[model samples]
Target chain A: MVKIYIPADTTACALGADKVAAEVALQAQKRGLDVELKRNGSRGAFWLEPLLEIESGEDRFAFGPVYPGDVAGLLDAGLHESSEHPLFLGRVTDIEWLSRQDRLTFSRAGVIDPLSLDEYRREGGYEGLDKALAMTAGEIVEAVTDSGLRGRGGAAFPTGIKWRTVLNTPSDQKYVTANADEGDSGTFADRLLMEADPFQLIEGMTICALAVDATQGYIYLRSEYPKALQVLNQAIAIAEAANLLGSDICGSGRDFHLQIRVGAGAYICGEETSMLESLEGKRGLVRFKPPLPAIEGLFGEPTVVNNVLTLAAVSTVLAKGAAYYQDYGSGRSRGTLSVQLSGNIRRGGLVEIPFGASLRELVEDFGGGTASGRPVRAIQVGGPLGAYLPESQWDTPLDYEAFTDVGAMLGHGGVVVFDDNVDMLEQARFAMEFCAVESCGKCTPCRIGSVRGVELIDKIGKNDGRSANLELLEALCETMDVGSLCAMGGLTPMPVRSALKHFPGDFERGTGNGIER
Target chain B: MHSSGEAPAVIVSSAVRKFADTPGGLLPLLHEIQAGLGFIPSDSVVTIASGMGLSRAEVHGVISFYHDFRDKPGGQKTIHVCRAEACQAVGSRQLEAHVKTRLGVDYGETTVDGRFTLEPVYCLGNCACGPSVRIADDVFARVDADRFDELLGDI
Candidate 1:
């Protein structure tokens, strides 16, 4: 009997993994081949999606981007053995991209069956929770603080301080909420982690509950991720049955109940306070700070609100010691950065490396430049709100302070590449339009300023008052930057300003070719 | 346009019974009703508000706030095209234009034949493959104008 592996991840399914799986099964049966099929998660090398793996003895041979049409030929070409086929890639681990990545959080991502408890346990899944349960709250917090792990969800806040705040707060009922509402574009690490190895997140959240003395936890996932929702729910149930979660967790007297709450397609809900509001069944509106979710949150009780990556890294921090995790990166940003390479690129996928790597290495070497084969014009780091960097800024290291020095942000580590065909003026306008459409309408600068920002860009594009409109647009960006209550309004100017500064010629050309609404 | 054939009230009551008691259950309740029926009927608001101890205005505000919820029924199928930067970098604008022209309907509008409803999504998280589209639960990647038509034909 031969064992075959195929990915059931959303990206793989989008690329026709399901159809490929069905065809493989049918062909194998018709050919009278003794084959056992297993559905696993993606290996994050998306270019090789629907990546079929055939396990022979100890090693797994790979075939890539396979479709339904490729299955019959694959079976005939000695699919069971490591045969020479057009799609065949040598041993899965030997792929340069997979071999180079320092995968700490995504260690079990594509290696294990997502829902198989036995497989997850074999790969060091719940060992973190076991170690966390043995330590006191202060020791757990100290370990996290020593790891120097900051929030990966854009803000770059210290994770240890947030946990310490929640631990020190006295409350009858506290909460540990994972911000899985990953609304940023060119980013899918949170979704990848949840769908691929959900047990890691569950184990991480359970460890958090043990650290903060929180009784309940909620993963505020966005409505866009239906697959993640299903996988997480199943994983939670499996963990509960195994005594990993519930009233008495893992033979301990403590209780921790976890649930999944789906967001209603609101991007602002990615904000921690807005997530708390949405969890309460209200419109996702941003709240004032100072009562920080740590002191007074989630039903007026203390809470530890963290990003998906932040919480997932907690498992690694506990299982391994703090010093072990802290030794990976440069400066304050420790641990691996999950860089998501997307947009017009020859090879776009997830690249997890330690901090301090240059952006040019990721775009040119790993991404293999543009898919269109045109000269690269710009690169947008972060999301819609992030700045657009020209070729000169590509050498900047991927760190929080390094990106800040270059007037860009490593927001969620999403690097979207664009060729020379792109229109910077148009991209700047879309940034304003996105802010206008998705703004929660809590602040005037974000609410009114964004709409006006769109109009100002339109006027500048048409050359109607040209210089005047440009000045007005700059002033408007400043107002939104300073007056807005949250990053939603404040960060709107980053892209607009960067576009104006780097690609001034696009505005001067005055084609007025605006995107159709 | 009520595709499920069950009364909107029945769907609303069932959803409320399942989620109303839970804290912060309104969003889940709304999702259930939308899943059962095609959309959330305005008449169901009063019932949901009363069940959850909220006002009708509060309920309406929530329904209007979210991009996913709709008060009126849509076409037989809803298609969401990603409009985020990653998709845009690989010609999603061209795909969007083609879809609008082919369907003869703008976003949030159903086709005359009630075959498809066009919607715009920020990101479907399939960033590696540009120009992603979602129909029902399935997401299609690297979709161009031609592939989109082929997908529509299959449906």
Candidate 2:
């Protein structure tokens, strides 16, 4: 029987993978051809989504952008016949887009049956947990610490230290929470992992639990991803049945129970404290600092709060050992980044590469530049809070410190590319507007300052207040930066400020077509 | 609006009771009630407040606070247009204008026939495929004016 593969990743599905899959099945059934169809995750070469791979001998043959209308033609063309169809790209492994990637976190994303526990294990899945189970709690924390695995949720806080803090904190009941609320506009890695490799996240969380001695865990997922929520919930039930979750894991007698908590439509909930509040069924308002989430989180208990990627990376850390995972990257960012290339990019997709890869490599090489075939003006390399880097700063390496040196932050590794046609002032105004809407109203600087920021940006656009207005806008941003409780307002100044700095011409260009004040 | 608020108190009580044992159950309970009745009625708020042993003010605060919960029910269909940076990069701002112009309603308003309600969505996590729209649980991507019209035409 010929084996057929279709990407079930949301990115692919959004691009009509389901239709292509169904068409393949229908065509095969009609022709009475023996075929096995499996839904795999995306290969991350999104330009070629609905990418059909055929099993022939040891290698999988690649074909892409295959639609429902093209399926019958493909079947007639003998897709499995030595990768020799018109759409064929020879070996799937040699596809340079994927071949160039250092897929530590997303290794299993496009390779196996997402829900099949057996396949996951067969492809070196449980090795991480197995390795972790043999080590002492201190040893496990030490391994993570040695790996230099910072929080992938943008803060770059040392994950090992956070776990150590949780482990040291004396509490009757401790909890481990995965902040899966990926609310960033250009980010979908958390959602992808949940949908494609839910077990990786589970394993990572389990490792954290064992390390921290927290038996109970919760993953606060964003509700926008209903498909991810469904897939993760199913995977959880499967893990529970398989003894990977719940009490008595792998006959070790150590208990770890994980649950899914979906967030309401609040972007601020992605913040750790706000997420904890939302988990407790309250409004996702940012809690004051002094008592960090590591010290006191989720019901006033010391909680191990790590992002989905941070926990998922743990699987690689344990499975491959500290040095193996650490050897891949340069600088303090000592691992591969699952870069989400989005927006106006031509070949926008997930690019998992070592940290030293420059921003130009991601936008120009991996992304294939702007979708409109126009010159790329600027790119936002992170979620909404990240600064917009102009073409001049595109030389900066994708490492955390590199971005910071350019007054930018790689919040969640989501790079949103923009063409020359983009109006930076409008983009700046949208940032303030987004902040105003998503703000929990917990702090006046974020709440009121954001509204003021919008008004000031609009005034500058209309050429109403000119230089002083820009100065006032800068002052207001400073106030929010210092006074705001969390990054929602604090870092919003990033895009606003970056736009002002890099694209000053766009600010005054809006004067002719005066936007309503 | 989706389903009518005929038995809002009953809906609220059942949901509240179901989640009574769960900690921080109020938000989920409120979500359930909203799902059932389309909008949480004043009567349901009182019912939930009593069931959760909270004040009406508390219940109202929560309902009004979250963007998900609606004070009044919308039209038969809710067309949530993506308005975030990714979507904006691909002309979602223009898409928003087109949607409003075509529907003859603003972002938060319902069409005169009660067939469509336009809502501004931040991001639906379909970033790679920009200009995503969510009509109920199903999220459609790369939605232009033509796609938008085609989607709402039958409904």
Candidate 3:
């Protein structure tokens, strides 16, 4: 029997992996091999997923990010012989990128078929819920606290503290919200996770509901990810059918229901308050603090809002015990982070590793250098709004505190690499333009500042404009940073300033001033 | 906002009615209605407002808010060049300018021939292949101005 495992990660699906699975099944059958084509989650090496694993004597031989058309070539190479092609050149475990990751949340990510609840259970999916069900709510919170799991949504907020607040808050309609709006540029970890092992996210959220005594949860997904929404919705359906969701989850009498809410083309909605606003079917405008979402969220009730990764990690901690998950990472940042490497890079996709891994290892070793093959000049860590660190900062570790200490926030764990050919000035302008377009425009700083930022950057790019406008630009960034209601306006300056600071040479004034033309 | 002055009430039809009751109905409904009926009609605006129990101004604000939603009919073909970070990293700006010069219209404006409408988008998630543009539902990756011509030539 030729049992082939195809990772069900969304990016793999986008690359037509599902069809490849069917092709593998058909091809294997034609070859007279008993083919059990199972769709598993990605192993986080996304560049290598739809990664087809064929069962060998002791272990499964891997080939990857495979396409339906590649099935013939794969078989022609002698599937029975297995280890002789460029596709399966490396050992799956020896890939330092995957090996270094202490995957608590992502444990079942690339292992089991995302759609099959049976495979999910076999790989220890709902074991977290079982463990959480045995413990009291306080014990559940304490275990999570001891695990030292921080929010992977980029905020690095203590997951336990956030849960505890919602737990302690007296409200009949407390909610567990998963910010599946993985809107950050170059980050597809959430989408990959949801597509690969959606049950992990479900199981995680289920455990949260049980721990916090909440009956309802929502996964707010970005509209750009239409396929992920489909996969997640289907997974949710399967979960509900298997008594893993809705009332009496895992037959524990804990009532939890999950609804997938689609985002309407707004990047700011990725933020907690804005997501809440979007969930309420209003404009995705950021709300003021003091009335935190933990106190009054999603129609004026206490809510436990977390990133998809955060909730998914909860399942691992609960299932394998907190200490197991906590054993990885550096001082403050514990556990592995699914870092998404994208942009101008040879190998682009998710790389789940311990929190303290250096950027050098991620970009050079795992990323395999830039797609353009030029010398690496600047790299934008985090998302579009993240800082553009020069090669000097390449050695910095991928941790929340480390990134923050150096004026960069590891927002959503997306590391977008850029080569020497990258024009930082243009990048800064694009950041402003992005914020301007996606801004909910609820606040003036973002609304006006973003538009102004574009104009000012354009002027700076032009040599005729006064250099004094640079100060004006800085002042505008300060105004937006302090005055803006949300990160949409506030953090937009991070990339802009970083671009101007790191690659000032790229921003030099030429003859006509505005682009090379 | 269309000056075609054809029929005024062709905007919000049955599709809008079907989607108006959905959880996140407004945007998709308007997009569907626009796709069916060239523009979001004044009558349909009222229909959407009444069906969704929203104010006409609120509906109008939403229509105006999103660059995607058009109160007027677009040209026969719409060419959206991704002007986002990834696309920019690989010279989409030049390609955009080239397309604009070729079509003789700026961004968000339609061609005089009514053959094309050029717009800017953030990203299509085809980062590995840069300078991407989505000509309607079909995404064209690694698109330069020259490749864009073949795409534009089709329409």
Candidate 4:
């Protein structure tokens, strides 16, 4: 029997994978061949999406961005005979973008059928869960702490500390949450992981549920990620069917059930407490700290809120042993960071590499430099709230401490490359504008400060430099940094100040220092 | 004002209907409507509001709040150029300017020919391949001015 899988992800379907799958089914039926079709999640290679995988002999032959019209020809060509088909000529494993990665978090993604528990089991999916079930909750937390796994979401907080906090908290009802709301621009690893290997996230959360003694878990995903929600819902159903979820998993006395919650298209919902508020069907508002989410989170109970990558990474660390994950990265940041090499580069996709790889290597070797073949100018590591780095800093090793030393953070390992034609002044303004738009309007500094920031950037851009504007903007940033409750308001100055500092020439070019509004 | 009873029938597809039927279905419902109709039309605002037990004004507010949603119908083709930090680092702004110059329209505006609508998307998850643009649904990453023109010519 031959099997064919077409990714059901919105990105893939939009590229005509659905139509291709239908055509394959129709063609197979017409020929009366024993062919089974499964709709899976995206393979994460956006450029090669609508990627079709056909079972041949012992291996799966891949074809991609395939249209319905090409289905019959592919069938006629016999996927078995040609290992060097235009699509599979570059084998999935051989692709540099995927080949170099230490794929712990994304190990099973794009390989297993997203909805199949049997396949997931066969592919060593829940081995971590099995190990986790055997260990005591404290032991599990210790193992994670020893592993040095940090949150892959921006901030890169230690995963073990959060789990330990939840474990130590006293509560009858505790909750585990996987933050799938990856609203970061130029980032799709969360969406891909959720869609392609939902079980990894589920297994990771299930492990958290056991460790934290949480009875319920929620995968808070963004509304824009429709396909991830669909896959998660289906994966949840399959897990329930397999007794991996619901009351008494694998007939164990422990009871854990998981659900999926979609966030209203608000970027701030990525914040752990805000996600909790949204899960309760209220406005997505940021909560002040001192009682971090791990201690008293999600309706005032103990909660273990983690990013999708953090949870997914937990599975790998638990399954392969802590040393395996601990051995990968530089100081403080452990395990392979799944670098979402995106934006203005030739080979854009997910590449999981050891921490401390130079930014130059990532930008030049993996990213293949700027897409336009223009001279590379700047790069933005992390997300929108991250700092903009010029060419001089390209040699900086990509690790948490190294980035921090340079007044930047290794936020989510999403590196976006830019070319020389970009205007630093405009890019700086956009950061403020995005902050203004996505601000929860909770703090006066963030709400009004962001608006004023945008205006100041524009004024600088237009050469309306009344040196006073620069001073005022800097002062506003200080207040927002201290006064704002969340990163949304706090980090707005990163890009603005960096742009002004790096490209001072751009500001002083047009306007007199004494020029007024 | 058009009579509520005599308003155009907001015929939702089975996918949209299924989404709208779920509890707390407003967000997904809006997403489905946008996916189907390009933008949330005035008719959809009323129908979705009624179906979800939300006020028309509330529905409209939600639709208008997000940058992804648009009130006016988009052109036949939607050109989404990534204007995120990464793309901007690679001179995507210049590419954007060139595109605007060629298309004779600013960002978020449709061409007079109804063939293209240019939008400035923050990112399309193509950072390693910056200066990426999605024409309709096809993402063209690492695109230069020449490649962009070639792509435009094809469409």
Candidate 5:
């Protein structure tokens, strides 16, 4: 029987993968061809998504961005035999976009059936858990520490230090919470990973539980991802049935129970303290820090709070050992960074590469420039809160310290490109507007200053006391940056400030057609 | 606007009973009630507050704080338009205007016929393919003005 594969990923489904899969099944049945149809995750090459693959001998041949209408024609053109077709791209492994990537953490993504335990295990999934089950808590923490694995959710806090603090903190009932509230606008790595290879996250969280002595774990996922929510729940049940996440794990007599806690639509909940508060069934407000989450968290107990990617990388760090994973990247940033190339780019997708790669390479070489075929003007790295880099700064290497030196951040590794027609002043105004809308109202600087910031930008755009309003906007941004309780308010000024610095012409050329107050 | 004949108190009580044992059950309870009843009815607030051992004010605060929760029922179908920067890069602002003009409803407002309610969403995680929109649970990508009209016609 010929084997056929199609992506069940949300992006692919949105692009009509479900319809294509249905068409393939219908065509096979009509022809009386014995074919095995399977749903796999995206290969991160989203441009070629609904990417149909056929297993022939040892290699899987690829074709795509396939639609239902094209399925019949593809079959007529010998799709089953992987013959000449316009959509066909030969072997999947040889695809240049995927072959160039250093897929350390995303090795199993788009490669195996996400929900199949047998496929997951066959692709070297449980080896990390097996190794972790044998190592002492201190040894597990030590390996992560040695690997230099930082939090992948934006903040570059070392994962080992957080676990060590939780391990040392005395608490009878601690918690391991994975912040899956990936609210970043231009980023989706967490959602992709959880949907494609959920067991990886589960295994990573289990390891954190054993290391921190916390038997209970919760994944605080955002409501935007309904598909991911369903996938994770099913994955957890599968793991439990397989004895990987129950009262006894692999007959080790240890315990780790995992559950998914969906977040109501509050972007502030992406913050650690705010996420903890939401987990406690509160208003998802940002909490004050003195006793960090590691010291006193989740019901006033010691907690281990790590981002989804940070936790997911633990599986790789354990499976490949510290030295093997650490050898990939440069400087303090060890291991590969999952760069999500998006926005107005021609070939936007997820590019996992070692740190020290230039933004120019990602945008121009990999992304193939703007989708509109226009000259690139600005690029925003990180999510909504990240700064917009101009042409001069595109050569900056994607390292944590390197970005900081240029007043930018490799935030969540999201690079959103923009063509020359973009209005930076409008973007600056939107940044303030977004801040005002999403603010938790915890601090006056964030809540009030954001509204005032929007007004100030408007006044500048109208050219009414332009210079004075610009100065006032600077002062307001400074206040929000220094006085806000958390990053939601504090970092709100990043995009605004970067726009003012890099694209001053847009503010000067504003037609005063700003968003309605 | 409790259009359903079922009593809000009964719906609230059942939701409360189902999630009362779970840790931090308020959000889930509220979610269940909304899922079953379409919205969290005003009269059920007191029942929910008392059942969960909290004040009515607290329950209201939680519901009001989150964007997902609503106090009243929306239109028959809800259309969430992505307004974030990534979408903006690929002409979502134009799509946003087209949606409002075509539906005769602004963000958070229901159409006159009660067929659709337009809402603004920051992102739907399909950034690679921009100009995304979500109608109920199904998210559609590269939604230009023509695509939006075609999708609306399907409904």
Candidate 6:
């Protein structure tokens, strides 16, 4: 009997992988061939989604972009000489997209069954937790600090420093929280990690619990991710049942239990403090600083609030020595960053590479240019809050400091490509409009300035008062940048300013790109 | 305006007990109420508010704060098209226009017969396969005009 694999990832399901998987089973049954079906998570190579793998004759053959109708052909070819067919992508590892890059956190993502504990253990999972059990809490935090692992969340705060804060804070009750509220428009790495290898996140949280001495933890996930919600619930139950998450984890006398809390569809909840408010069943509002989330968070107790990627990376940093993880990237950024290549690009998927990789290499070479084959014009690296870069800046390395120097950000590492025909003015307007819509309304600047921004940008788009409106827009942007409490308002000006700087052609009269206003 | 309808207190009792032991149980209680009854009834707001020892205004604030929690019953099917940067980087604007024309409705508005409701979502976390649409819980990707029409034809 052959063991066949199909992706059960959300993107795969969106691509009709469910129907294709069903067809594969049906076709195989008709052919009277015995086979065991295993649904695996996405390998983050979304371009080849619905990618099916078959183990045959000492090799696992891969085929992709498969549909329901193509399942019959695949069954015939897959059962016999699977690797020789046209759809054959050779070994999935040999694909240049996966091979040319480094993968640290996402190594076992698409390769293992998401719900299977045995498979997770086989892939060297939970070894970090085991290692943490033997070492002192201070030793675990030292390992993370020495490994140069910062928060993969937007802030890039040192993960070890946060655990150290919780470790040092004196409290009867403490908490460790994972910010899975991935509300950014162009980003989905957090969602992919949760949906693929959920246990990795669980294990990472457990290690945090052991280091911080916080027995209770929570994962604040967004409401839109139904698939992720289901997968996480199942994985949590499985982990708890296996004693990987229960009262006595791995017989280490450490008790780390986790719960998944859903966020109401508020983008601002992605902000750490706002997420805390939402978790407590209130209207999501931005909390004031000075009494930061590290010192007084989640019911006024010490909490370790890190992003999904940050926590996931902690597991690997502990499993492999800090030096092993630190050797991959240059500068402050260590280890591989999972870059999401999406929108308008031909080869759109997850590309995990060292931090120093060039943007041109990602957009032109790996992405294979725009899907429409049009000449590329603009690129937005990072989430929606990131600035739009022109072709001239494509050579900038993808490090945080490098992007900051360029007046851009590598937020969540989602790189969205735009072609020559794109309207910079229209894209700029959407940024303000998005901020206006998603604002928590706690701060007046984000609440009021964002609405004013849309109105001013609208006048510019309509070519009604070009010079005057542009002046007002710039002033409004300045106010928002300096006055806004959180990034929602603070960074809304990034796109608006970048568009005016780089693509001034679209802001003129009779040159509007979108349907006028 | 929401229609005044009677909701059994037993249902609210069960919903409250389901998450009563957990701290900050209002959100889960509301989710349970919505999931079980489709929409949170206007009268049931008082029931839920009292069940959680929260004021009616507080409950209403939470229910309206999030986009997903609807006060009234919606159409049978929902078509949520991505309007985020990634989808717009492609041509989802055109898809939005097509759906509006085909369905004869704008975003947040339902069809005349109430068969379908059209809405705009920022991102469905499926940015890699852009121009994505989710009809109910099932998400469809690479959804061009032809594919959308074919999907609607099946419906």
Task: Please identify model 5 stretches exceeding 4 Å from their true place.
Answer: A80-82, A510-517, B1-7
- Residue pairs of candidate 6 with colliding backbone atoms: none
Across the candidates, what are chain A's individual TM-scores?
Answer: 0.98, 0.98, 0.94, 0.93, 0.98, 0.97
> CA lDDT of each candidate?
0.91, 0.87, 0.78, 0.77, 0.91, 0.86
Model 2 chain B weakest lDDT span, ten residues long:
B1-10
Q: What TM-score does each of the candidates earn?
A: 0.98, 0.96, 0.87, 0.81, 0.98, 0.97
Per-residue lDDT tens digits of candidate 3, residues B1-155? 34344444544556656866675567667756665655676656777888888898888877776566666667876677767665666677789889888889998888887766787766555554556776655556568888888877766
Which candidate ranks first by DockQ, i.e. highest? 1
For every prediction, compared with the true complex, DockQ reads: 0.89, 0.70, 0.25, 0.26, 0.83, 0.78
| Overall local distance difference test of candidate 6 | 0.86
Query: Interface root-mean-square deviation for each candidate?
Result: 0.6, 1.2, 3.3, 4.1, 0.6, 0.9
Write the residue-wise lDDT of candidate 4 on A1-517 in tens digits.
7888788765566556777888998998888878888887765665576678876656666776577887888777766536555655334566656677777777777778888888888988899999998999999999999999988888888889989999998889999998988878768888878878889899999998998899998888876565677778988998888889999898778889888876656788888777777665445678888689888788888898889999988888899999989999888878888888776676666777889899999878877776678887778778898888887788899899999898777788778777776677777889889888788777898999999988987776666755888888889889888889898889888877777777666566465542132
Query: Between the candidate structures 2 and 4, which one is better when assessed by lDDT?
Result: 2
| DockQ of prediction 2 | 0.70
RMSD to true structure for each model, in Å:
1.9, 2.2, 4.4, 5.7, 2.1, 2.3
lDDT of 3 at A429: 89
TM-score of chain B of each: 0.96, 0.92, 0.86, 0.85, 0.94, 0.88
Determine the C-alpha RMSD for candidate 4 after optimal superposition of all C-alphas: 5.7
Model 3: residues with Cα > 4 Å off, grouped in runs: A6-10, A13-36, A39-41, A65-71, A81-83, A94-97, A511-517, B1-42, B67-82, B90-120, B124-155
Tell me which of candidates 5 and 6 scores higher on TM-score. Answer: 5
Give the C-alpha lDDT of model 5: 0.91
Q: Quote the lDDT for B32 in model 6.
A: 74
